[model samples]
Target: MKRPNFIVIMTDQQRWDHLGCYGNPVLRTPNIDAIAAAGQRLDRFYVANPICQPNRACLATGQLSTVNGCRQNGIPLSPGQVTYAEVLRAAGWRTALIGKAHFQNVTDVPAPSRQAAGKGDDLPASVALARREQRDGPDYLNEVRAAWAANPDRTVPLPYYGFEYLRLCIGHGDQVEGHYSRWLRDRCPEAVDLRGPDHALDDPAVRVAQCWQTALPEDCYPTAYVAEEAEAYLRSCRADEPFLLVLSFPDPHHPFTPPGRYWDLYDPAEVELPASFGDAVNRRNDLPDALRQAYRMGDEDPHSYWPFHLFEPELRRIIALNYGAITMVDDAVGRVMRTLSEVGLDDDTVVCFTSDHGDYMGDHGTVLKMGLHYQSVIRVPFLWRDTAQRRQPGVSRVQASAIDFAPTILQRAGLRVPVGMQGEDIFAAPPDRPVLIEDPGIGVFRDPDSRSALISLVHDDWRLSLLEGCMDWGELYDLGADPNETTNLWFDPEVAGRKTELLLRLAERQLALRDLSLCPTARA
Candidate 1:
């Protein structure tokens, strides 16, 4: 019997409910839906954090942001950390990563957190170590677009974060540049003129922010490039060798540019706004100042990466374009899956589909993501299809986080999971534990008195979040009673007792997940 091959198809900024199988009535995702139909669909699967780099780092390391030290978007995953891909590669599996690998910072911008702080002796020793330590190397610049733009021939060093071969798409939407950019320029030199909002089709009807009708054809888009490369890799695979290939799509994220027919697959007029959209906009005064600022932004689309408020009509346009991008990704997925079957590796390969994080997508009147942990931003689709496992095919509401992905994949591949990985083998037993989400916010929360660092615990039907750097305000929600999170029960005295209990659990969970990989050889 041969070890099973792995194909992890990940999409950027896609929420759980955006898929047809996930109860999305508007999006046509027959291919992704087919994967769900044949596999176990995890209903409550959440990201370790709501941001990109941190959660992706958690996925690769099987550890939380605090343990892995990638607490925000600009922070690169430490080169010292071990990834499951490295484990599989070490075991003689041919490892390849195609499309978006955001393991490193995409831009050359310095993080605000790295700014010099005021001199303070009150800070703990751990904070001193973390703040002063230089854990990354010069290779950290491998993913920066400026570096690539300066030298198009440069590529990431081999075995990057465990991937032996990487076909990287550095940024999101059509503007993405990396190996994909070089390939696109070579394949179609004219594609350069067709990229970005400046070259968008003349469509005044769509007034959504960060959305443009790309002039590039469907085949020339990043999503199509990823599928084509993945197909080529599958075709090149030898029968005697097992491989792990990641088809990561940089679509369905920001600056929605679905090329060709994908741009108009869904009509913005027909798109439906989220249930909480109306309430959020109408009752902005009732929300915390931190959250209400989004609603006050009105019609202006700053086009900045941070979440911004949008009117119902503008949000509808975003949804429509987002749907178009998603459908394009679905088509690409269909192509890859068909290639798997064509190469006769369908039955032997484990196909898993998930996303790094999710977009706000009109949830609470916000468009992008940051400083918020609504289900719209945190919960994402997780589909697992393995032929060797006898696990019944059905929806598993058992909560799981991005950290669990690494351990689960390693266990399924019959590899020994590293002792340092904090996540459980979700397949061996239900991870009937609370999911912890950590986010060191990037100034998205505009409140001066509030610090943006957040720690949330999701268990059963209750969600509790503690906003660090400030003690006066926090969030507590009864997800069972209010799935839309319209009400924050943090101030409700009736739930005071329950909130205390959950806080204690959150503390215990945080301690439990601390890095125990380093054992002291000497007690002194």
Candidate 2:
């Protein structure tokens, strides 16, 4: 039998609640919604890290961010790291990456993490977050430009981490660069400039990074670029050759610039504030004093959003823009799905759509993301559309993460999984698996005393966040009772026993997650 083809469509900073299939009432994501309707959607899906590079690294290597060695945004996956692409290729799969890949450190001269991604004990939280070492690292645009000038038509950009072919796109929003920049220039040179400055949005109160419609034509948006490239790759695939393609989209992220009519898709008045934001979340506040202090800008605006003086109404507008961006992505997804059928590869392909992580998106009054372990930032959408699996279409409450992504894909392709892979097969995925989430915070916690390295565990109905040394101040949420995660129960006397039990559970879970056993024990 011919091995199955694979496609993993990933978006940046998209929340699980943003999709129509995910119980989102307002957003119309027909293509993605249909994909979920075809197979099983894991409802409790999450990422090991709430940020980009780390979890993307996990998906690439099938290991936790701490273990894979790219735990934070600035750190690059080690060159010695054996990504699943390499394994799948060795297992007789042709692979290509076509879009944003934060796998490499994105530097001309790569910086190897001395320790694995989030395993740096000697590093201070500020140091880890600040990325002081990368201050003078080669500018990404100049490096990509010079590299392309020197080596025209380089098959894979910077060896593409592990992909055999890459049409790499870097930068997000109107600030697009790399191969995508060139592609946009070719199609819509003016798109390279965008609708204009955020000030052009005409709302004096609107921040540059807040919701806005760009002057650039919708056809030339990055979402369109990725969709076109994915179809091109699908069309180019040989008739009998099996392939693995990762088309990562960098949108619904920030600089909330949706192109053309998508900008008008949602009205700001229709946007609703999350129940956990402001007084609502604070009324039953379980946020650690330290976490609260971190969020306390004290009359100053948090840099999470532009203009920073965000009121409830302004946040709603931002949410509306975020919805628009999701719609735009949905349209791109529709085009790619149509092309998959057009190329006659739809039936044999195993397609999964997810995101690097979820965005705050006005949840808890934040815009994008921080190291927070709230469902808004850590919980992402995971859908598997496998032609081989003929199960009743529905949502599975199984806890899933990017760690399982590679093994799941390889399993669908009928390829042997590497013994070193630390994820379960999706076909037999553990419904009660304790999903581990890691966040190597980007510089300075809300409280100066807090640890920068955060480890969160989503086991069953409880989500616990363990601070790297400050154990007492860590967060524990009874997600069963407060699914919105409005209350932090870390120091609550009522749950002291529960917290202790969870601590022990976390200890055991950590051992399981940290185990690097590459082979079964052989007794002679």
Candidate 3:
């Protein structure tokens, strides 16, 4: 049998429940649903971290964010770290990443400085900035829009984080820049001016927060650009040589702007509120102090990147617009899949669909994602269609993590899973292991004294989260009972022993996940 090709389709900030196959009643994702029907759907797939860069890095390296060192959104996947793509590429497999290869920081701005308390080690600000810039490769800023704006001719250097050919979509929504931006400019220069809320088609009826109807035609959108590029790449592939093509869509994220006809595809008035939306019980009993305060007083900076509470009207419109974006992506997927079949590669290709992470999508009245361990944010849709007959085709209730992605792909391609990769081959068998999710430095907001980091453990039927700086305030949800995660059983006397056992399990899992990528051959 021929070594199977790989096609990974990933979406940004999409919840597991937002797809047609995943129990979403309203959203029309027939293309994605078809994939699920034809193959295996991972019902309980979770991300290693509930952030874009960190979880994506985890998928690339098959290592946790803690091990790979991409612990947050701004942090880039270090060039030195080995990616599964790099391994496959080295082993005579072609690798290409199209659309939103966010392996590096998308913005030119640096993260908050954390200096050690030592007067002698302090350096001048300019020198410090220069040194920081030199930390990553010279092409580190390839994804930054400002850098691209300054140099229009700039393109991602070959073999970026293991992908040989690249077509990057930097930033989100209609306001994206990078290769897609260049393509859009070439196709329709006027479409560029039509992006953003400032020039959005007036939709006074829509009351979604940070949502607008983009005037850019659906064909000119980033989703279309990704599908077109992917189809072209598929047509360019050699039948004999195996290849890994990753199609990452940057849509269905913040500042919702589905273009053209997709804008009016769903009516906000008809959209129903999430079951847990504005639940007074969870707000009062389950929320940590910071979140409780935010829920009560409302977010001061609603437009900021951090997760915030949203009103019912705003959430309804947001959900409708988000569905529009998702539907557009689904259409794009259908286009690419048709191209794959047309090119006669469908039978030989191992196709997988998932997301880097998920958005709150109005779960618990929240609009975005962050440190929260809510199912809406951490759990994502994962569908695998292995036409090679390597894996069984059925809905799997087995819990899988993003870390398993690389290993699964490698194993399916008949490649050796490299040393130091912490992920198991998901297709091999059901892994009866607790999924460990680590989010560092996600503290309680507005509370100056509280500096929290989140570490969660998801086992059979329970999800446990330990917030480091919020005193004894932790979250324990019985997922079997309450899938919406409305009730907190952390301090409950009845589940006290269970909580202790789960905590012990979390500690054991952490210990088990320790870095073993490299083993010492010689004793010092």
Candidate 4:
């Protein structure tokens, strides 16, 4: 039997409920919906961290953030970490990455020379800054690439953690950089730089609370660009060779900018806010004073946090734009799926779609995610389709996560699961393991504070969260009763027993999950 070709499609900051198939009443995501209809969509899928880099590192290496040392956004994956791409490549599978690849650090970025100089170099700030500004490499975010594009070595990265070839799109929104920027450079120059993280172009339609439409045509959007690249790869590759291609879309994230026609695809005035929107019950005044001070939630980031007291209308527009971004991604997926079928690679390929994490999407008056562990932020849509076999499509309520991806892909490819991996195989059928979600730090996991950490466990329809070293006022949710997570049962005496049981489980999981992959028998 031939190995199955794998294509994993991922979106940035898209919530589980944003899809038409996932009970999203407003959006039309037929391509993504079709994938679920044809394959198995996990009812309870999640991410180890709600942020980008850490979760991506988790997906790539099949290990938790702590194990890989990329606990938050700014920390880069250690070059020593082994990823599924390397394992598959070693097994004779060709691998490539398109669009966002947030596996590296964005702050205090190292130059190629400095990276080669090894970790302990104590260079002055000026020299290090100069070197990093000149470097590019495989930065997963466009902002990072643009910041370090001067270093010619960035174009020729030192080694990608595991991927053999990567065509990185480092920016989000109108801030498209790297190969994506070049694609738009002369082709659609007018729309390319309409807006960016630092500069906003003079377009009225492109202003929706960090959300906007660009002058770029729908076909030239980054979402579409990614599909084009992936399609080209599929057509160029030999049909007999197995390959791993990850098409990562960097939209539906912050700066809420969906380019071209997608910006107006959904009407903001007609868009309804989440059912739990503005429920003060979502507030975290319950946390310890220290944690509360550290993560002010709605008070931290002004761009993403628009108070109804002054900007209720803005939030609605953002939601519409968020959905618009998702819709565009859906269309892109549909395009690629068609290309796969056109090239006759559909039957031999396995397709999996998911997000790095979920977004708040205006739930409880929040636009994006942070330290909150509500279902809106923790639960993500995970769907898989194996076209090689024909079966009734179904939804599996398995407790799984981004970490499980690498192991599953390896399993699907018939490659040996590496001993160094900590993620579970997707088909192993482990019994009732609680989903563990960790928030490694403040800002750049980018939160409001750097002094706190959050860990959550979801098991048996209950979710429990604790602040590291501070437990007086952590959060507990009876997801069965309050599916919207409108109520936090932390102090409710009626649920004390439930809380105790979950706490014990969380502790046990923590003790068990700490890096323990060393093979003693193989050692002398």
Using TM-score as the yardstick, the better of models 1 and 4 is 1
- Residues forming the 10-long window of minimal summed lDDT in candidate 2: 134-143
* Model 3 regions more than 4 Å off: 118-134, 203-207, 281-298, 388-391, 441-450
Once fitted onto the true fold, the runs of candidate 2 whose alpha carbons sit more than 4 angstroms away are 106-159, 195-209, 280-309, 388-392, 444-450, 515-524
Model 2 accuracy (lDDT, Cα): 0.73
- Model 2 C-alpha RMSD vs. true structure (Å) is 5.3
Span of ten consecutive residues with least summed lDDT in model 1: 442-451
Residue 399's lDDT in candidate 4: 89
Tens digit of lDDT per residue, candidate 4, span 203-290? 5555555654455667777788899899898887678998889999988787777766677788878876777887755455655654
lDDT per residue as tens, model 1, 1-524: 68889999999999789999999878899999999888999999999999888899999999988888887776689878999999999998999999888888888765433322577555665574445655455778888877765566776789888999889888888888888878887888898788888877857465467888888888888898999999999999976899999999998999888888887789888887888886653244544554444434433445767777778777887899899999989989999999999998888889999999998888877788875688999999999988645435788878899999999999988888897899987776565689999987644433222355778999878899977555787889899999998888998999999999999999998888988767688977
Q: Which ten residues in a row have the lowest lDDT in candidate 3?
A: 441-450
Total clashes for model 4: 11
lDDT of 2 by residue, 1-524 (tens): 76788888999889888899988878889999999999889888888777777888888878887777666666666656678788777776788887788765454644344342454367654566443443333322332434643443444434455577778776566555557766776787555345445424456454534445577777887788889998888889875888889988878877778877877788878876777767344213564543444344421455343213256877877778788888888888898889999888888888889998887766666666764678888889988887654435788887888888888877766777776778878668768878888776533323233356778888869988876656557778999899888777877899998888877888887888874745457864
RMSD of 1: 3.1
lDDT of 3 by residue, 342-406 (tens): 99888888889999989888887777877468998889999998875655678887888999999
The TM-scores of all predictions, comma-separated, are 0.93, 0.85, 0.93, 0.87
